[model samples]
Target: MSDYCRICLEEDALDNLLIPCNCKGTQKFTHKSCLHRWQETTLNNYLCCPERYDLEQVLTCRLCKTKYNSTSANFSWRLLYTSSPLLALARKHTCVLTFGISSFMCFSFWLFFPILFNVAIFSYVVFWKKGYRFKFIGTNEGIRLRIYKIGLKVNELKSGTILKATNMIRDGMFKNSKILIVKNKEEGAVGFIFNKFIDETENIRCGGPVNQSSVHVLHDNPDVEGCEKITDGIYIGGKLIPRPENTICAIIKGYSAWDSLQLDGEVRSGLWQIDNTECACLW
Candidate 1:
């Protein structure tokens, strides 16, 4: 492409005047005074103060007031269970009946007792309290899970954390360019998703649900100026939604590419309470 004067829109390449104001001049140049007026109104207005938009807010759960830290990428709460020995015996009986019926159906078609026993076992187990309540928190770094089981030696355990949200996005990496943003497309809300854990020099990989199409982007790429209130999930989409403080981020770390953007019926119904506290995204 031939060099042209940006300011005058001229096609001159020699004796051109170039200034920091991004004004392009040619041999047949426009008056310098004209350039001054253009610079004051057009370019300067768009310039922003660095400090004005650099900081972001931290995130927390609205329910328990639990602030998810950057180190803890995701958080969840599960149901707890209590002891009931009477229920256990009933569950045991049901299992016996189920197996007995299967055996009889194969070898002793003539014996109906086994089938009856199996049916009884099925009912008790289905209605019994053998299942425990559980809460699960998954993050890029690890998982925090609790099982409420009566008489159990331990109530909680750290199952594991995700090394990366997706194979492409690794831990501790961020992408400032070419990020994928998802939103309602109709509502105009927007969220950001970039390749994390990028080598920067060699490879550009993003941390997310591996597949791009499954992720939802938020609308309105608003500056993460402060800790904003936790509204609907639409306000925050794709990967972990970082709080305004920059200390905590909301993430669904272990979900697969197919499951990344899906909101379960329960979550959509607003059945779950959000635990709000202060936290950030940690590697």
Candidate 2:
């Protein structure tokens, strides 16, 4: 009546065996490594069941189809750190290439050194940028901006009236909403907005313009329900909403702006008036 790992078929040991899922007796325990390997191999078999999928990696028991509770704990740091599929693929590729090159050319240090150096530089330029620059141009009523990379633009705002636009980039009217504006020594005048803020999880996106450069705002609300993407932008609820139109606002980047000041709480809050009846504001 000894417990054994259902995955590896090995006798249960203290460090190796884990009761990941809610199964009884023989089907209960599995080796962490074995389970992880199986999950990795069969990752393609999982489908997006909106009701059951919490946007996390889940391991289901093959025998009973019950999802394991401890799957999160078993995830490696690489898997946990990658929030999107593209990033996960990048990490996997990097790991595989590094391992393959190191194993095959362990003694050919001089030959591979230049290749490795070029790869590192290429990675830095492609994946990491020197800095983030946002340009906000003033509209008659509000400001428009975009995010730039190496002088090339990536994100642009979707066209729409003020209300139907993505709330990710808010104007002065959205005061009292959880968005903030601040000045940074390095980044200059910047705005901070949250796409999702709950408990320990906080995701910040920013948008801004220069000269008459207003800080385009990027807000994240991860808990928003029933969000659907359309050709113009995203449709959350019944509204045909456009994505944040400005480049600065459309860029899907996250940063921490804990020191930013809330518009309603700041001195500038007096300059604007919120028309609750119309759901827009005048500044």
Candidate 3:
């Protein structure tokens, strides 16, 4: 690091005259590793505060704003980041920037990839629905999992919707069950048969078979202190207390629960119909 080196301006050490950017005198000569570190820091700053910092500075001189001649420093430049750190604060965000770059590159590749030039990078599965047919691409081991994740996001069910069991669900507990969906997410789903009422009080009737011990009160009371709201005027949880007139409530014990992407399969395979209008009068 001598006075000649633009980055570490010290007359204590010695290094080669690595000029990455076109700057006069003091700003020209920077060590290869030093220039790389500088580029990394610049990119980091640009990512953290995009409005304040410029991205072009990572490959150019700040003063002259000329693109850096990184013909030599381009090789294995990221390996020298641990040597000289830019700032000690917020070092955890390094992966975020790296992931952002990787994601962008992956998205670009997937977007621009033509239907003609399809390479055999990984295994795939063909999905047929309606009239359109496209291949679902994924890796070998985790392809099924990836497919499930993608399917869940696209055709996933939402909470507060009604699921009427079709004839496909033979003579099971949910055969004629018109389940009122309590909650539906990417992970799982929980609901109960609201249409079936055994009696006024809890005798033998239940919501579902999963959680039989617990009791859930589905009511139209939103003013209850600790009740979970479902849709517009419906609320779950909390006990049945004396409330306003015309506010109907169902004392349901036990509820149905489905694991990740489990209900999606049943729904798609024609086990149930996603009816928002048929089960409206029941609640």
Candidate 4:
């Protein structure tokens, strides 16, 4: 009236039945209730880790894969820091065009063609800057910008800005290269040219145009150290020249940003451990 269970490594009552599941490279056996609990625990534990590979592995720690509830935690303030400026502006502009346009249009309906020229000129000047917005955003699904004039819908403005050609040059081969606004142009700006070369050799480009010469801004900042300025207007964490056009005030390494986001989620939910194996605590 007894059977052997692989989990407990002991004999149990005859009513117990051992079943094998398709878990690869691992084995376990348990009572009916225990088996179900084991499966749930195994599956939930596997789902908790962040997908980004940049995080270093941690030992002797466990992450619980629980649904993060932003509302329940009173963490609404987190939105202010994470939401991009371009996204906020897009929302504001759409509201103004929808409610504000009705008044402007009805008042002008009778004035008709006489004021049409002036109105057209005014509308063009006001909305022309929107085109620059569509460049960077380029078809993002999470948000959409509505374009309108005189209560008539026009087009959709997309997100993102194009990295323009600059005098900056990167040493070694370039892959996934980007322009980053590491600092303020007035206070100073910083741009980084990440080199994904096999040797992992990163070339630093830091400088800003002062008078006729491009000065190395990172060198002057005193915050960044041990980074060599390869050329003028080249330094680690220097101000971006011309600034991020439109609403893009800055760009960091996209991967790094996503990592920060994951950490933010964990912190908001109170799931982050000071020594969580998966979290490097870069935040």
In TM-score terms, candidate 1 sits at 0.20
CA lDDT of each prediction against the hidden true structure: 0.33, 0.42, 0.67, 0.33
lDDT at 146, model 4? 36
Model 4 C-alpha RMSD to native: 27.2
Top-lDDT structure, candidate number: 3
Kindly list the per-residue Cα lDDT of model 4 for residues 39-150, writing each as its tens digit: 4444345335424311111111122223223321113223422443554475569877777788788768867865887888777776654321112222335445534212
Worst 10 residues of 1 by lDDT: 73-82
- Candidate 1 lDDT at 192 equals 30
Weakest lDDT window of 10 consecutive positions for candidate 2:
154-163
Please, what's the RMSD in Å of model 1? 37.4
lDDT of 1 by residue, 1-283 (tens): 3455445666644444332221223322332333444433332333343233211111222223443233322121111012234434655698887888898787765577778899988865654455433457565557877443222221111111111122232333231312223321221222233334334453233435434334332222234443233232223333335433443232322122212212121123332122222112221
lDDT of 4 at 93: 94
Instruction: Give the C-alpha lDDT of model 1.
Output: 0.33
Give each model a TM-score.
Answer: 0.20, 0.23, 0.44, 0.17
Each candidate's number of clashing pairs is 59, 19, 1, 21
